[model samples]
Target: MNQQQFSSSHIPGLDRFWAVIPAGGVGTRLWPLSRAAAPKFLHDLTGSGQTLIRATYDRLHPLAGNNIMVVTGQAHRDAVCDQLSGVAEENFILEPEPKDSAAAIGVAAAVLFEQDPEAIMGSFAADQVIGPDDVFRTAVAEAIATAVTNKIVTIGIKPTYPSTGFGYIQKGEKLEIEAAPSAFKVDKFVEKPQADVAQRYVDSGQHFWNAGMFVAPVRLLLQHLQSNEPELFEGVTAIARARVAGDVTEPMAEIWPTLPKTSIDYAVAEPAAEAGDVAVIPGDFLWDDVGDFAAIARLNPAADESGVTVIGETPRVYADDANGVVVTDTSRVIALIGVENIVVVDTGDALLVTTTEHAQSVKQAVESIKAHGDDDVL
Candidate 1:
């Protein structure tokens, strides 16, 4: 994963703008459907005929053209390459192991900075489902515009509910940047709150859902990384430098596993906000993390006859008065009768049956399986 893999010439309309997709995470909540070898990003959770990561690449292609880089685990190398075939082999920033978003995204910043010092990179999660391509691109345009001013900008989704699952971002005064009129100074970053506290924050009309989409000059991002976590910064920078020297195999194997495991929020965003060096651009578009089976049900349209949400390729499904999600990957006909808010996931080696009310606890089942030495299904 080095700059030498692709042409250095910038795309006409998207010069200096690089879109980095961080495609890590096993999505344990998704369990059987999403495995360590093939995470949620590799599946079409929305049943839209395209995988999540593929959709993400399509969404950002217009904004970045060929200036796209994906940071992912080495285990997913072949799968990611197949999905993102348009992306160059050198553009794929392969991580030796899971070290969290900081290392995943920091290495991308370092690589882009080494290749193009003036590069403004935007890191978007590869597993997120966002819609109305025009709206998302517009929001990203504003984020890029704000990032040009040397501020670390994040695209904040307008909260639709007081969700305890996602973090909240408090916005301060509106920024008057001509290119980004809807931008605002970030007041602070808040962790996921309790139900009551989340309600208050949402009612106050001052908070936005933290979607973890960051846009900043690669140099500025590295500078912040150096200031907050010098050891981690040194590790990623060394990898990037190695890439510049025409090889990253030695450095990646030696330094990657040793990098500190931390998200970009704690490594850079939160502190940058405290120092008044962060900004937020309102993301006025449909967005979903597709975190669990509940999200899967929400994303897929219900079957007309049975009112059930069915995903994956199945021979037949006979449902009578059933309402919920059913993810199948077998030839057997799934017949559900009088089930309410029930979730059924049938795979080759696993079968999960639960209700929507207990969707969040599906990860616990995965944990239990691990404890019982059942790693094959996992």
Candidate 2:
């Protein structure tokens, strides 16, 4: 994909648009800091004292032109408000219940459509970090342009490593247009693969990381949802109609629980890929979803040895450790000795100790905590 093929008609009035940020996930892998009540998106992991949601909002504000919509569970409304106090109150779409991305994006699409049927909406994850704002803006502009003429347009990150943690997108035939230089007709979408398979994908040069960033016209999105996922579309449309009628808060809460819990990828993207209605734009910005501890470790400043400690308010003491991660609260001192490839996270009420290789199983650890009726720890 290149830049010349995309014309102004492809992304009409992109500068005047609203951005949808889905912040409803319980980041189980990053527990105990990322608890069910307060996910990773609300935490200040970067040590720069800014929450992830704040950083993402700041990064997208320029292109969104001060219009932003955040979709989150009702349980997280206060935190979402606290983090995004700068945004308008009406812009926050608090889900009455957790219905996953399919419902969340559907609701957002309905809201955007009501505002402007032709409006271009950029859907994003609250946990991702993309650098070089110019690159992101350019790619998003191209996506918006493509989305005007296409059903759905997604930003595909140029893979930097053979990472098995993310899904991949296979680029198909190029479009014969000068305005859309970086856009391609998507051939297929692949889920996370094994190490060998991921390596092959990386070597193929035809694959790109599915960044989960999307852009589309509000009417187009609703049409696709109505055609592909009638249940989700109907639920969200009812919510929108209820909001327009009166008493939005009560009806939203009552209707959300009845919706299905499915991801947008499974409900829409994959189906669109199979139906040949999706397109991909090569993303040039440095991006990271910050999905796990390993990704965090990689983003942290390089250490002389193999280990790195992320110190919060609490001081961390380390000795005889290699390739280990130690996270602690601000008030206590965490001491580590003779540990390698280990992760030690000390919350005020709970502690998690696991090997780096088993970090992905932290969700299981949360389940154990739940089994013990220690919801406070979680």
Candidate 3:
């Protein structure tokens, strides 16, 4: 609830930790409420009173202190700065355009390496909702400890269900790290699979949901990046060098767009795992990406006794035998009668009405809107 609450740190090597937040998704699956101008990270979807990005920063600040770095797109610069008040301007790495996670995290590693070669950088996406602060921080501390051994580390969430939506990390054996007791060698990374395969993964008890939270020493991360993607590594390093020398405007404009587009998982994590250089720490905490209306429904409490969840400043909503989620940014009164598992989001310019079962189809709707040249709403 307050910064002072999470300020104390007893974990070793936490002083050298640098938290890197990659905030670059459009979140098209949460359309209407989440758009190009304002992505899901900018919204408080969980009714927690803090924006997702702000909450993310709050969670990481205690571990990293003032060493938090946020890498985001150029378009959301002012909004991001407004939300993260105390973060230094120099700590914000603004990409001229979106180049996916590898470029964003790669450049941040390069920049932090220049500032502190011993920096232990942990990359967490800006939009994920993880909680019971203590548990999450503990896993991260273990990740930091494992990273000190010059191995790439990631905090994998202990699976709660057979979720076909998330990628899986197959943890191999216990890694003997004195500082990180729960560290395990990552055997392999698996793509999102069918329901039966997901069930098998969950049943095995050796697999964890890949939360995309990676921790590694800056120098080690750069070495893997250079080894795996030499061109991308070179480009990001040049931009980092330019920033240290003077203005990064020229170098960023020239190099950033040309960098190869890929995710850190594909570029470094998978390959590193194959080489037995990656470790996974099981995170026993609640986690969610808040991906769509269904996730929004899961995070918020029901409004009144009616089985409907309401968010934002909707004046009033009448529901009779209806169960669903409603997000309204306007004053319009909404009434639902006899409908089940419905989702209604009303922004001034766009209104999205869908069922929980059809939540993932919102992306298709967004694509149709784009095809119709409705960029104004987007």
Task: Name the best candidate (by TM-score).
Answer: 3
lDDT of 1 by residue, 1-378 (tens): 122322223222146899999999999999988999999999988878999999999998877889899999999999999999999998998888877999999999999989999899999999999988778887888788788888999999998889999999999999988867899999999999999999998898889999999999888888889999999999999999999999999999999989999999999999889989999999989999998999888888786867898887754778888888889999878999999998999988899999888999989999999999999888
Could you give the C-alpha RMSD of every candidate to the true structure, in order shown? 4.2, 3.0, 2.1
Give the runs in model 3 whose Cα sits over 4 Å from its true position. Answer: 1-10
lDDT of 1 at 358: 90
Q: Write the per-residue lDDT of candidate 3 for residues 1-378, one digit (tens) a residue.
A: 233433325455577888999989889999988887899899998888999999999998877888899999899999999999879999999989878899999999999988889888999999999998878887888888899888899999988889889999999989899878999999999999899999999999999999999999989889889999999999999999999998999999999999999999999999999999999999999999988999989888695899999998554788999999998988888999999999999889899999999999999999999999999999
Rank candidates, TM-score, best first.
3, 1, 2
Error of 2 at 213 (Å): 1.0
Evaluate residue 293 in candidate 1 and report its C-alpha lDDT on the 0 to 100 scale: 93
* lDDT score at residue 76, model 3, on the 0-100 scale: 98
Better of 1 and 2 by lDDT: 1
Worst 10 residues of 3 by lDDT: 1-10
How many clashes would you count in candidate 2?
21
Q: Considering TM-score, which of the candidate structures 2 and 3 is the better prediction for this target? A: 3
lDDT of each: 0.89, 0.79, 0.90
The lDDT of model 3 is 0.90
